[model samples]
Target: MTVTGHVKTAPETTAQVLSAEQRHADELAFLAAYDDGARPPGWALTPRAVVTFIRGSDGEPLTLPAERRTGTLPATMTVAAKFVGERSLVERCVVTLAGERGLLLVGEPGTAKSMLSELLAAAVCGTSALTVQGTAGTTEDAFRYGWNYALLLAQGPTPQALVDSPVLTAMRSGRVVRIEEVTRCLPEVQDALVSLLSDRRMNVPELAGTEEGLIRAVPGFTVIATANLRDRGVSEMSSALKRRFNFETIHPIADADTETDLVRRQATAAVERAGAAYTVDDAVLDALVTVFRDLRSGRSDEGWDVERPGTVMSTAEAVQVAVSLGLSAAYLADGDALDLMPGHLLGVVHKDDQNDRARLLGYWDGPVRRRAEDGSAMWRRLWDLRESLR
Candidate 1:
């Protein structure tokens, strides 16, 4: 649900939609009886089902749905999700949670770090609402507690005046807490976690005399933090702090077909949301994907050399481009949605810093333009529009 538009996720059948993880409540309880650690009541699945939920049952075998009704997960249980490649990275995340360790998801922008964190939290705890958006302005109070200003003025800072941070709430309730863009916080501000992770407790010394001092993390409690590799001035996590968590680095999509599937699926859904009929054909979508894939990897389909722009060529941006073109065609153009071509792409490639514009031009000089130079009419039209990029 990015930006509150017509964008939607893969529509799931009614059965696939776990209206509330409540459906899995019994199954999770069954697994918990044998679970080595104390269980978090109301959890959808034991840590195991939670793992299966995220790793997805793509290649795994399962019994039929009817025979294994009670205490059994679905046989056709597959999440029509879109995180590409690196099943091991996904596995590592689930494994880390099963160990009750904090999981820090690290990845390049657009590699789905935020999405994976969201999915992982949803699968593990069945809710993704407990999240903290980190910024340089983020304070230690964000990780622990703050005073409710009105109450504090009236009651003079009593325990009841305390307002809990999302992290504090998750710690107390034994749910997964997410700290998004973890690196955006200042180093001193980020250091506030040293005690939270090590002690597994938060102390509100302000209310020490009245017995509201410490909040303890119950069983099944954990934290999932996200950091984008592209952010500069990210506060380096201390080794001591890092030791308390397991780290999983998500890599970009490694397959063309898979990446293409992602573009087509996600983009089409986005276009339908814009109150305009979708008219961009598969050929246009494939061309957009191909351009992005080549620009991102610095290589063409024929194994030809091309220089990559010094920018983060993230898929999220690509999705936006497809959606943008869709909107442009839907609102302005009639019938000829595919005509957007290089003109639409100009808006995207130019935003990638100055050198990137040059790189895009360099890309144009080669395959992109060469195709225009050659007899391919598609490339010729795109080359004709190159002047608009300047």
Candidate 2:
């Protein structure tokens, strides 16, 4: 079958990445039956269930009431946490959506802002495909509507010729639409959403006097947008647009141990997906996380001052570094994963500024050397490998 002008293909079994909805289809279905409480219109799961879906069930199995049990779903299930943040934050996001208000998640790069948006959309609407990836060239058509030139010319400005943008489609269907990196879009293009959100209706002047001309949003329709804090000055959001949405700041994982575990879990999954055993040692992983946290926060675990890199040393980047280390350990038989750290770290630090290399070297001279002096064998090895930074 075709959607728009393109043929829709069957699900690729070997897809490298799956959307939140596809990855957690079973949990969604189970949660739908698991929660019989009131749900906002067009929502697949109740508000509470939506929260539970994103922030797992804390290892406790939830039993489906016998009356609601079905053959496809198990009797009892333990929901797995997909987004690693506070349950209260997820609850606030759900509440915002439930009220049908526009939600804007603002955060530093790689803070799982997009991941949280996808998870919430999937839990609420049963699909996370209605999305617009904002960029410098994005235009009003992306947030409002577009046209099929062929259909427009052949049939005139009719309903069939009008192509629905993701936001428009979401409005009509009463589902959630996600705008990723909203700040990347030009200021004028970003304004398209202000009126749309405020009015909850879009006037298609091209189709004026027709039944489909004025498109009104149905119940449960909402918008979820994400903006990276690093992109604040790129295209600052207008006050009007900001007022239409409830803003939530997604912070990086606060606890070092939690961040380390997340990095390990995500990196291991990444390596295994590449068909390799993730054999990176725990000690190496701990040291790697320590380096990332120290650089990102500009302070060492021991409270020693360290220079921050120009490039954001995000957890997501740390996971990639861990994945690289794991792959090197798995494939490169002669090399230790610990020995490969300096080069990968150098690559991350050197992204935006070459001067960051000096900062990285300084970190080694301070934290790594001090830890080595404190008799940590792992830190000692890392210290010995400082020449790798050059």
Candidate 3:
């Protein structure tokens, strides 16, 4: 039988981003041997180990306890934190997955819902590739199964003619399947999951007489789906569909320092991928993240009422802006990355509403000017560059 799933490609040095499994192969292997706790049926790592894989060992070296040691694994290893969020939230997600329930992560765009999903899947099942990208054009066949048309035409609906969807493959193999932007799919197409999730099995009507027609999920089969708050009304999910999944709201990083650090690290990684040195000053990054937070929260850190932009000023967007500044500093010219902030901020603010331009200017007039008045040199430079917003 043919499977319709992520096509395996030979590793490319220039691959912009590697799968969670590919990028953290060593860590996953280490965690497996490090933890001897009982794993759910068909899981690759214990629930605790899975959480550790995502949250890191908090910079401490994890020494495999005396009894669980195998000569194959290193005696001690350090796992870097991958996701930046509450450990309790990660624990809750792990618990849901261990119970084999559908997990629905709802959040604003770029809150790392998808990243969390990938990490959980990779840690649990050793792969984050069984995926269905939900879009308005997505059809039911994308969730169920398709046919190898050439084979189907030559030999009727035999088992060999079946092309398993990612969801079907996950069911047969007892792995986690991810559906991104689940709400973007048409309601009818989204309903296709209700029976599969509720029954934990799928029936192939074309091959009804054959034993292969009925495919039941083995243990460890579950799903992790994501939805953007911005797309909530585009295709509302039926109450039946919502009932099948445990909903978790993923929020933006609450602490300014944590968010700034994450932006610096991510932007540096991105610039390095392009073979450029990241030279954007930490001051510039802090300012950039400050603007995003102000616009995102609709209030300045100092309790000033700033006009919020209609567009989402997310942390992910802050990283992009920082990367742009870094790239400009590295490749284009010898100037402070701060010089380009206004233009980038303008670009981001103009995404959804034209009036947001005025909102951004209001932000500059309010917080930026006040910070400049308070003798902050970085804010002073940003204030001088205010004409760029026009």
Candidate 4:
């Protein structure tokens, strides 16, 4: 079905922010409250409901009437498809919320760590905006408190000058505070979390005389931090800090069909963003998915020898390729644009590095040629002229 084009607005939040239907589902989640984890101090749905909010409901569907939630209530959310590798890993993350422990998600880049953390924050807290990106320069003040210099000088140790970091706010409010790229921070810099986790409070030494000292963690207070395994040469975390967190390693997607579906879904959203209609034919879509699947895992569908590409064959990259092909046909060529079978994929496979080109050729010789011989015209042409690029 061709959707009429609508120019995308510059979203104040994410494009995938839930809609009205999801809003109903969210309230129903709290109403049903089928063990949505432990409730943070001010939170409605328990941590379990928060998990159900992010990861979709396997429970019976809700039939509640839709009503516009006017106040600044937590936006209803669902975990996206990118993190489909495991269920136990996600469960651990959700359980970490029930405790005061920090949930550290370590994985290779493009493993959907950041998005998962963001979704978790959104579901547990009312907003995913409470975040501190951990970089080499991330100061201890970022993890704790920062006094407003001007306000502090003017008002002394008053509450006005007592600027609260997300961590401090979460301690007081009992919401999930997210620290992205935990390994990117220096070893000592990451250690700022040690006291926060142990005491579940931040001592405001400067404001010692009044109501501003010792911000204690509320019931639902916890941290969700993401670290890339690929960022090894940079700042590595210390053992003590790692001990404070419940580590959940997010692995890459195992199934080719799952990845293909993710690529198609993400690509559609991207194309719709640019006001372009996505009409990718299933044959071409399957071919593109096949090429990606083969190159990514270093094995063919028939378990034949297929060389691995040096570059990462991430689902993020797959969406890019699919979006690219959709754009090329929608703007430059004729008829349905979806009819393009295998010609467009050749260039996408051969980019990033020349070694990728060699692997792609090997894939063509093995799988594409085999499929062609098995009687697919588009693949047959692709197999025969595979070396045209090099």
Candidate 5:
């Protein structure tokens, strides 16, 4: 099915990554056509369809009307599942957005919290470009609004002089606004969201008595913020700010097969984007993901105790290691990338803390030695490569 207006028409560039809206425009269009369920105010799709778009269909084909199947809109289109996690979580998130409530996703780093937020915003509002990246230095201007210095100096605090941040714009347009790493911001800076969320309005004293100063959020305005639980104690959210959001915790991929599949898919995409052929073997990816899971959980699959590293052994790190292994193979013309896994893992483990080396070595001495003795050739090879870690 050819979707006309919504699909991006720009020429494909190697390095550019399209937003969620542009990437799945056809699937969204298909769902919009097939289901005519009622949508909340300012939403592009119904709540149910939004969940379907994120969780994917059960291979059931969605048939469109014969007349509407013109250019890119085919007669039948199957929606591919975007998220690899729980369907109930996606439903809860969709319901929260439909109710115009703030949603906060907290998890260990690399659990795809940011990706989920982007997809949810795109599905509900038809755009995910409105975003605020919270950091230690993030000021109130980021959450509220800023003034155009030149316009403000010449005309004073007029409508044209007011510069809208993503939050303010989302309020006026009733769209989803994303705040990434909310816990990274200072507590005072984070508190700026309390009044805007509770009152559903942004008051600008600079332009008081003007129509532009008192900007009330329309019916569909909502916030989707993500925070890394690793930063739990640092710049923690105030009780008031926490009360405004419906919290959801995104756990790391539990099953090894699911994690390996996600790593393969994401790594292949990364490799292709780098203009390199994907040559990483499945066995190598499986081993890589297994080792990561073991290190992250501080236990071998067989229940041996392993010391966890200070660094986060997240799926994102696994994807990076896979991509690096693929790139090494592509450039060096190496036959198999399995041999490079140990070195990549060593690099990942020793990232921020020098003491993590000892913890990693503890893992190599315990789990790696045990797995080697268990008759797995890959584990045996990894065990032999333990000297490389020193």
Candidate 6:
């Protein structure tokens, strides 16, 4: 069996975003070889090793064999931490997956729940492509199976006529399947997983009495679903459905410095991908993150009260704002990147709700104005750009 799933080489210039498994294939290999601990059945790495892959190593050098040292994997490789949240939460998530219980990540929009799900699926099953994007239109077929109309018409309920959903494929292959925005699906549609999880089998009525009629989940097959808390009322999940999975609440980044670092790193990668030079200054980044954190929390670092907008002020949005600043600095080349931040923030704040603009103005009047009065040059410049919000 190949350690990495279907390794394929791509030209450097054309290589776009890779899945977590493909992008971190070497790292996974190194950890798999280094870790002598026993892993759950069908798992690519031990639970501890999986945590290390997600939370990162403690800068200690890994003792690698000669064969493992290739490309970026040197003799002493340190796994860079990917997720920026609490290590204990990740440990719990890994432990839940190790137990083969479905893991459901719930959080506000942009808290990286979906990203965490993808990382876990990749680390556990060596594949993260098996996924179902849950939406209002998501039906029972999305969670179980569907049929190829033409083939079904011609062959009449034969195996060839069956089209496997991601969940079914994961069941057959013993891989991890991701369901994004599970709450977005209608309640009745979302309950389709209740029996699938409890019974660990899916029955195809059309193929009854045949070998393929009943599909049983293989070892290591599990679901990792994510739900945005902001969409709670859109479609509530049933109690029976919620009981099948272990729920984990992913919180937003609490530390401004850490959030700023993440935004800068992601934005830099995005800018590089766009073939542009990243020129956003560190001071500008710090200022931008500070403003976002203050407004998001409805209070400044000094504990001053401010009104938050209805829109989610997330780290992911910060990355986009940073990327916009970088692009402006790269192409516009006319003003400081900090000068463009207020405009970008305004655009993000004024998304669907017009009342959010009033809330933004309140934030500016409360925090931005006070920060500028405190003689911070960055805040002073940001205060000057306040008129742009209007």
Top candidate on lDDT is: 3
Q: Write the per-residue lDDT of candidate 1 for residues 166-260, one digit (tens) a residue.
A: 99888878888899988888878777887787788887887775556768888778889988887676778777768877888887788877877
Q: Which candidate do you rate higher for lDDT, 1 or 5?
A: 5
* Runs with alpha carbons beyond 4 Å of true place in candidate 6: 1-11, 65-74
Ranking by lDDT: 3, 2, 5, 6, 1, 4
Candidate that would win on TM-score: 2
- Give per-residue lDDT, candidate 3, residue 25: 93
What's the TM-score of each model vs. the native?
A: 0.83, 0.95, 0.95, 0.79, 0.94, 0.94
Model 2, residue 7: C-alpha shift (Å)? 36
Give the runs in model 1 whose Cα sits over 4 Å from its true position. Answer: 1-43, 59-78, 373-375
Q: Which lDDT value does model 6 have at 216?
A: 96
Q: What residue runs in model 2 are displaced by over 4 Å at the alpha carbon?
A: 1-12
> For each candidate, how many residue pairs have backbone atoms clashing (under 3 Å)?
1, 0, 0, 8, 7, 0
Residue pairs in clash, model 6? none
Model 5 residue pairs with clashes: 1-72, 1-73, 1-74, 2-71, 2-72, 2-73, 3-72
> Between which residue pairs do clashes occur in model 4?
36-46, 36-47, 36-48, 36-49, 37-47, 37-48, 38-47, 54-79
lDDT of all the models against the reference? 0.72, 0.90, 0.91, 0.70, 0.88, 0.88
TM-score of 2: 0.95
Q: TM-score for model 5? A: 0.94
Q: How does residue 138 of candidate 4 score in lDDT?
A: 86
Worst 10-residue lDDT window for candidate 2 reads: 1-10
Model 6, C-alpha of 345: deviation from truth (Å): 0.6
